[model samples]
Target: MIIPFWSRLRLAPRIVLVIIGALLAMKAVDKAMPLVIRPPEAMFFDRDWLLATLQDIRDRSITAPAAERPALLRDLPVRQWLDITLLSSPPDFRHSEREGGFTDLHRRITDRLGLTPQDVLLKADEPDDPEYSPRPLVIILPPLPTVIMDVFDDRSANMLSSDLRIAFRIGPQEDWLVVTPKSDGQEIVRMTRNVALPLLAVVLIGLLSVWVARGIVKPLDDLAEAAEKLGRDREPRLVGSFNAPELQAIGNSFNAMQLRLKRFVDDRLQMIAAISHDLRTPLTRLRLFAEYLPDPDQRRQVMSDIAEMEAMMSATLTFASTQLKDEPRSPSDLAAMLISLCDTAADAGCMVAYEGPDHARLVYRPVAMRRAFANLIDNGCKFGSHVWVRLRETPDAFVITVSDDGPGIPPDQFENAFRPFVRLESSRNRDTGGTGLGLTIAQDIILTHDGDIMLSAAPDTNGLVVTVTLPRQG
Candidate 1:
């Protein structure tokens, strides 16, 4: 199925979009929550109690001694959510260019106190400034600023535009008095809820970002693993599904390249195999012609040359066919296979012995692996008088060492030993019945199975030690 454009958005874009969407969703929920659970009329502004308190303060300022008036308002206990404070003078007000809608409320407050409208000041809720709100509201309050006190309600005092806020001078000689409701526990809860909503939204967005990051990284991880397998010359299976369009395109291109490389290699091997097979016919005819030579010495030389040509042609065909063949891997007993090969060599009168675990199971192409090991054991027996085949298992892989007591090849010639038809006389010889392809074919088979082979001098003896290491399967 075709993936949607939204599903294939890049990592950065996807995370940004999800955060924006979450913020919008939170805003929608915030707007709809109040409608779902509406508060009753009882929770609104208590106008009666507010006006009565204002009148009581005004009456006290008129009757109390001038010096004691400030104390009288300050000493008034906060009761029924009403908080009263006395100030030296009125606070600064936001001077409106045009008369605002609070003129009726101003007149009402003055009438309640039996005073003129000039003695009373009423302010509707104003837009909150982060630096000005939350604080005492005194720092930014102008030399004659209006007092702002926190009042308890379902919403913040700063958010309620219709709240009744009043500031007025108590008496002509007394200080100004500010009266407003103090916040209760419910107000704190309301404020906390407002704050927590945005934080909750942020946490949810972070989790969404993490999920998108994993989705993006998982495909790249798959691509890297497939590339590693390809480098080891093995067919690797890659996950086909991808979350991003760019990753999908990259995967397709990589698979196409692997297919092309495989086809090209197969074609070359097939051509080599065909050539080797065809050359055998000519070599056989030469053998027949050599048998009828007049001079005995010439006949022997010709026969030797023809036999060597046949051996080379057979080895070449075998190498090409091995490379061209595709084999499925299965679990096989490696120890048993090595023991069997050693027994066969011993029966053929060679000094060969096997030493290792009785059973070592590993996943591999058994036919190809068996041939590679056989060639290694045969080469060892031909070059050395005594051959020892040992198997050892490590945490990650199994190691097999074939040690032979023979003149070892120089360290510098080790790398060239695996080349096709290249023989080092110090360690290998034509008389040894090797077409110089034994190590070449073995190395090819080992690499196909993601294994490695190395040559080193035997530690305790004058011989060459061939070490083959194959990785363990999960």
Candidate 2:
């Protein structure tokens, strides 16, 4: 059955549990390894050599001359794998004691060699470096897998047991003999357990962290991308089945917000369209009535007033339609479209010129984008004698600029110009016949395509420069 463990866990608790589980698993492996693996007994010392050497020493103590006993013991063949040292006095025995496995080993060696208890001494310890120090008769492997083991010194490695040493005498006054194994295989086993395994566990933990982080970060990245699409008027909904409960809740909320926001925008646009459409019928009747008025001046004045009102209403309806329309985007040649606009304006007796490449492909709503650029070009021609439409390409975006040498807007009024029905009277006068919806409509269209539009003063003249930057869609 599916348990859905990750779905129920929050992010913080999940990360903590992952780390703790890894540590516990390493600990279990560390404890179980010693029972499963052990160094070869022959690697320490040959059992046959040990038994023969002890028997030779026992025979030498009785039959050998007292003066030649040291020389005979020194020539023993066991020196190849074991160190046999002869000291003028007995070695330090203040801390040496026979216990556990060492006590049994001492008793067996004494019985085999026919030696008294006072003639032999044995002590076993857990050694840090068995090659350099005396190790226990029965080896105890390193325990615990932790990062702290990396800094272990000799003292720390030997902390588990006491000092291990064995000494013997042929007679009460004879020089003492000390035996130590010379093989380093036991040290290799200890280092492999104490140092190598922990390092391996560290690498495993790092990989585990990367795996966990990717699992958590993927859903967040999807959420961020969805938010970006929503801002660009692309309705996007997030999935509810994120790995964690907290992220799933956020996804559900984001999906709900997208639905509500789309409904709100659609309702407001519909209301505006209905109001604009209803007002036009009454204005049409008024226009018909004004034509039959007795006074000519009053009649002309009434007709002009009615005409301006009709123009305003028409602009309002267009604005509403532009917002409510959901146009499908496709790849189109933006440069060709700009050139056509320039040609049309030139044919109408406006000094218009187009500059840039012959073809530039971009993904956008064709009709909406054409209307946006058309407004910019027309506004430039209306205010200035000459208008320049230039398109440029960058690595990541396409930039279009429309500049006119007319009276430019003041820096402070730049933001206010984009507001609906806002006409900067100082720069753009009433004679221009603009309802002030051109820039506003153009901004909405460009923004809906995930593009930017900004207004600035012309560099070399008193004119307005409109710059539009659109991101490259992949």
Candidate 3:
């Protein structure tokens, strides 16, 4: 049954059906409410008329002879809506002055009848009669359920148990009146229709809205996550299948784009590697020829040139071969790694100090990350006397800062320093014996790992500070 019900309707039709069904159910309840519930007697009869009638009956009963008083009260020719009755002396009624008492109704009736509050007596419950049946009085009104108690208050009708009977004063004859009004079932029906059902409907609609919204939004969120992963890695896993047609189409497009990009990058890297490899043979032959030169001074100059060429070629080949994404990521102690690097530099007589947590674990390509940090540390050791390394962890990323107390590069030359084969003549000269590809290679590796490398002047002194920021694992 559930399968057929769901199979028949698409998304749009299902939404429409839910809305129409709710409206129709509310309308049906509104129509049937009147038939199921009846209005109170107070609604049909005016208060003034009811009060005057009660007063007239009481006055006539007071003046009538003691023997005729009972008949006079019973046959008062009152409205069909009202039931009049009289009770004998020692009516055995129990009086309760508490909640659900007709205090407000009694006051209004007394004022309307031109009587003070003290003149009227109001009591709840029934007379405490010994001979009275143990069974409670029950009133029946077809279609609508009837309540034996007063509609406006909790007072039960005494007339339901006995016919007209009255108590009379011996010398100055007088009589007191008692009245009971039925409750209007319409109020309950109105509350259920206007308030209760609508509130329930609102809650149900909200739940349905959330369910539908998640169905549409979850796929888009997954697609966005896949795109981010692709940016960080060359061989990113492709997004899987989706239920929605539009989302499935988007996923297929993203997979195709990733495949094409990977192929293009692979071809370029292969071509560069082949070219660099072929050039090495000629470079070796050139070095052999330079060694055989007759003039010693000329031969030294040729050797120096050949060595520079060879250094450039080696740096280029190294940069091309070490693809950052190719390295697999694994859990490692990042703080320990930084400390070890600093220790190695210190052993080599470079004044380097490490300061940070003793053990900070993270998933990363250790070899590539080590190489990147090594380049930065090497540059600092060559240009400055002292190097300080600091590692700090943030909520979403890890930061490693390497600051050196060397002659800092000019602010304008910062961008140029990261370009391959570019060096700052003022601070970093050819005499430093660098291929000028260190920062460039480091930046490339950091970018491939979805991290960033930033260079700035040391805050305390004149030197360069390199800060690397890498995303933290979840």
Using all chains and alpha carbons, the TM-scores for the candidates as numbered come to 0.57, 0.63, 0.60
Q: Which digits, one per residue and each the tens of the lDDT, describe model 3 over residues 1-474?
A: 254564444567666776777677667865664476432222223334655666677677667887896676666667244545554432344333434224444565566556655555554343243122122222211222335344323343212221212222222324444544432234345444446656866776677777666766787888787777666455556888665556667889988998898888778867866787788899899889988899999999888887887777777776767556588889988898889999999999999999899999988889888988989999999999999999998999999999999998888888898988787886687887788989988887787778888899898999999999988852
lDDT of 2 at 120: 78
Candidate 1 Cα deviation (angstroms), residue 64 = 31
Model 2: lDDT of residue 386: 91
Write down the TM-score for model 1: 0.57
Q: What ranking emerges by lDDT with the best candidate at the front?
A: 2, 1, 3
For candidate 1, lDDT tens digit of each residue in 367-415? 8888889989988888899999999999999999999988888899999
Q: Give the whole-model CA lDDT for all candidates, comma-separated.
A: 0.72, 0.75, 0.68
In model 1, which runs have C-alpha deviations exceeding 4 angstroms?
1-3, 7-12, 15-146, 149-210, 228-243, 293-301, 322-331, 394-397, 406-433, 450-452, 455-457, 461-463, 471-474
Comparing 1 and 2 on TM-score, the stronger one: 2
What does the lDDT read for residue 410 in candidate 2?
95
Error of model 1, residue 324, in angstroms: 8.8
- CA RMSD per model (angstroms): 11.2, 10.8, 11.6
**Local error of candidate 2 at residue 346 (angstroms):** 2.4
Error of 3 at 103 (Å): 20
The number of clashing residue pairs in each candidate reads 5, 0, 7
**Candidate 1 residue pairs that clash:** 91-144, 91-145, 91-146, 92-144, 92-145
